[model samples]
Target: MKTAISIPDDLFVTAENTAKKLGIPRSQLFAKALEEFIQNHSKEKITEKLNEVYSNDTTKKDNSLSDVSVAILRNSLKNESW
Candidate 1:
């Protein structure tokens, strides 16, 4: 697949240099980077969805530890006389 990408000149220079150092064409370097980026972000999206589901399920029950907020902890500390 042929696509046009508008990359910043500095970044392009660095990428080109890296490709040269690795003895690979600049196109291959870009393809590998795109593949890795897609895989990583896909996993991140799945993890985010799982976290959302876990949070929703826990909300229906008494899960004090997971539900505690930073504000609540700060207020508790402030109210303490010691």
Candidate 2:
């Protein structure tokens, strides 16, 4: 596919230099960059959807242990030399 797009001169120069240094054509460099950008954003979209689904659960649960258990655990930890 052949297409044209405009970018800042500095970016264009940098891409050109990178392509030369990597021994690839400018089109290949642009295509690779676009492909990588799309793949990354696709993963981000999945994460966003997972976050949206999980965000709807507003329920909170008490996960803390009883005071006696906490005191025993703390005493055991204190006896161990760090």
Candidate 3:
């Protein structure tokens, strides 16, 4: 597929330089950049969903759980040098 878009001359030059330096065709550079941009954007969406899932107070840690965890950590680390 072919598509056309416009960008500033300086940015275009930079992209061309980067593609040449990396030994890839301009199309491959653009495609790789777009793929990374899309992946990062999708990660943001996944993080938002996780935040929503953990937003409730019921998802928060309580004192008993913390106490148990601290006791276990202390027991495991007592014989080890700090």
Candidate 4:
């Protein structure tokens, strides 16, 4: 895919220098950087969205745990051979 992006002059200079140091083309460097940036920030964006939704919920809710289920969980925790 071919696309156009405008980066600041200083950042472009740094990117070009880094690309030369890594022995790769500027386009490859930008693509790799974009891939990493998306991978890192997408997870962060998902977490932020989840936090926003959960924090905005004002209702105190009941969890559906039965007494037998709680006892089984406690027994499992007490037993070393889980």
TM-score each candidate: 0.66, 0.67, 0.69, 0.60
Best by lDDT: 3
lDDT of 1 at 52: 92
- Screening candidate 1 with a backbone cut-off below 3 angstroms (N, C-alpha, C), the clashing residue pairs are none
Local accuracy of candidate 2 as per-residue lDDT tens digits, 1-82: 9999999999999999999999999999999999999999999999999999888744432223465678889998997988
Per-residue CA lDDT of candidate 1, range 1-82, in tens? 8999898999999999999999999999999999999999999999999999877865545556545665678778996887
Error of 3 at 11 (Å): 1.1
Compared with the true structure, all predictions reach lDDT values of: 0.89, 0.90, 0.91, 0.88
The per-candidate count of clashes, in order, stands at 0, 0, 0, 0
Per-residue CA lDDT of model 3 for 1-82, tens digit only, reads 7889898999899999999999999989889999999999999999999999788676346767888999999999999996
Q: After superposition, how far is residue 63 of candidate 1 from its true place, in Å?
A: 12
Worst 10 residues of 3 by lDDT: 55-64
lDDT score, residue 21, model 4?
100
User: Which should have the higher lDDT, number 1 or number 2?
Assistant: 2
Ten contiguous residues minimizing lDDT sum, candidate 4: 57-66
- Superposed on all Cα atoms, the candidates' RMSDs to the truth, in angstroms, are 11.5, 8.6, 8.7, 8.0
**Candidate scoring better on TM-score of 2 and 3:** 3
On a 0 to 100 scale, what is the lDDT of residue 5 in model 1? 89
